[model samples]
Target: MMMKKTVCMGLILCGMAFGTTAQTRGSLGQSDPKAKVVLDNVSKKFKSLKSVIANFVLKVEGANNSVSDSKKGSVYLKGAKYKVVMGDQEIISDNKTSWTYAKDVNEVTINNVDQSGNSMTPAKIFTNFYDKDFLYRLNGETTEKGKVLQNIELTPTDKSKTFFKVLVDVDKKNQTLARMKVFEKNGNRYTYEISSFTPNGAVTDDMFTFDAKKHPGVEVVDLR
Candidate 1:
């Protein structure tokens, strides 16, 4: 359960790595002007902020539209580093190495970061996902609790991709991301909603790395 949840979280950051190569993506068209404008604004917002901390709810649904499970978690993202906490599991990475801690099992796994640039991390997405893999367009607008939201649809350029589409909701007034929904070809839907967002939160470097010494009696499996 912990591993699956961590992978789901990682998928959001590594969407650009799936399926096709950059050369094969040449035939794709430019992003729709409207969508480009909105995403550009969002990228700028992320750049101006020092860091980000958010609480989120993740919902997983089956092909029949029935909820398989739901979990609440918090994430801290700062540049190429991030830490995710859900239930008794935590995934921490510093763009160089990663650590997965499963408290219930009293175990930790360590591995080196995949430096191939084939995968996009959360930090990479915040900085520049608009330039690759997807062609996006405005999906119209809707109001939530009286707040206006601009919905944008992103279609993967490669039809062979596991997930065909992604929907992003941006707050029109604040120019911040509100929610994201990913639809998978396997009939699984992943919905991530941000319940709280704090920009420029105080973050330290050590927070992104894990130290097994801090947790005595934990088994360490080093895969590096």
Candidate 2:
């Protein structure tokens, strides 16, 4: 039938397009030795911390090169648990159950925390994404706002990923992550800048869990 032929042709064309894109993406391998040293130091430092508190600014640039207003936010991390406060939404996770609280709607959506190795949560990126699933290269060092930052480019091993490249800027002086930028194949760029960081910050277990009883008349949507 003509309809069946058309569908077959569409599938073939889609496959061709995907093949072309995959050829242009970077493949995973060992990182540059210089870059490895920096990353290893950072990973060790992060693992040694009991908890961390930090303030960040997020900037999203669209495909057309139009940049959105930078949004300021805060993050609290203790092991796999984390609490992210940005805009009117507060995301809290105890590494088991995750709750997304929308202040505007006075409602919360509960979902199970993704335990997959490939899950790309903010906490995962801040602590462990570079350690696996990526091959990195030292893009050399750059001075940003008068601070020397070591720039590293990470290419995902999985070519099917929406984000093909990630750029991480580490503060050489303190050996801490200062900024990260994710480049998507769709031409969108996400930039996260860490303004301040405090390791071993005071955090209670209760801070990572959401109690609906505290919020009067709050609606809960259990998706888990």
Strongest candidate by TM-score: 1
Model 2: how far residue 189 lies from native, Å: 0.8
Instruction: Give per-model TM-scores.
Output: 0.89, 0.83
The TM-score measured for candidate 1 stands at 0.89
Q: For candidate 1, what is the lDDT?
A: 0.79
Candidate 2 lDDT by residue in tens digits, 1-224: 22322331222112112121222223344668888788887777888889999888877777888756577788888988888887677878898998878776788878897676434455555655565566788998999888999999877666787777889899998888998887879887777789999999999999999999999998888889
Count of backbone collisions within predicted model 1: 0
Ten-residue segment with the worst summed lDDT in candidate 1? 15-24
User: How do the residues 1-224 of candidate 1 rate in per-residue lDDT, one tens digit apiece?
Assistant: 45654665565446424432443555776678898899888888987887998788888888987658888988889887898888878889999998888888888888898887766666655555755667889989999988899999988877877888889898888788888888888788888787888898888989999988899998888889
All predictions: root-mean-square deviation over Cα? 2.3, 9.6
Clashes of each: 0, 0
